[model samples]
Target: MASQADRVAEAHKTLYDQGLAVRTDVTGADHVHRSLQNGSSDFARPMQELATEVGWGSIWTRPGLDRKTRSLLNIAMLCALNRMTELAVHVRGAVNNGASEIEIRETLIQVAGYCGLPAGLEGVRVAERVLDAIREQQSGEKSSTAA
Candidate 1:
């Protein structure tokens, strides 16, 4: 069997090469990469490992689905599962993968039809938070440009 560290390193390399970078949501990808590199046993270690191996390596690296489409599927699934927190994380990832707010909104609407109204509503709520933050950042950029 492949060692856990090896799997993580491969996943990290794949993610970097694909240009799918994580934002500064918490500790950042570098911190997680180091922890995975050193084989640390912190509280979130398991999740980090799973993210590297399963989320990044296995699923995200698949060539059949484009990153944007995968992100849309992830958002829909997370919402259906009532995973609000992880949903937010993927929402950010989706935006990084070139998913526009309008696309996300349409996805949420589609999820509503398939996953139920509550699930879709929760997705919209989380997506709105991310969208608002992005809008704020853009407005700040515009104001700074004018100055």
Candidate 2:
């Protein structure tokens, strides 16, 4: 029989695995590679681990909200908190979660009204950059496949 400690460790591993999957689905394999690789940094290693374990595993995996809703909520909250860097990342995540451009626009509009014009404008700028990258990447994929 597995010991209690063993069981706990196994569960943690399972959640970590699930978190990786969830993150990959939302952020793409490329983003995951850049953000969470073992070679990235030992100093910020614990940050990645905690994000994977607690944020992605515990909160994001919850059934109360779908991934798209969560993505939108993250955008709004990140804007409200003026976390433009994380907001940019989650904007990409929002697209991956199936949020349309108009949906993103509307969310930013609300952010402008509620959060402040500066925050909303900055969020829009970040989101536009992320969306432009997505469009360019998709265009490249389509062109490459046409060859």
How do all models score by TM-score?
0.71, 0.91
* Poorest lDDT segment (10 consecutive residues) of candidate 2: 31-40
lDDT of 1 by residue, 1-147 (tens): 889999977766766544323322222475446656665667666666556655665666678988788888988889989999878877877887889888999999999999899999989999999778778988999999999
TM-score of 1: 0.71
Steric clash pairs (candidate 1): none
lDDT of 2 by residue, 13-131 (tens): 88888898898899889877888775359898778877887788888999989999999999999998999988998999999999999999899999999989998999999999999
Worst lDDT run of 10 residues, candidate 1, spans 18-27
Off by over 4 Å in 1: 1-43
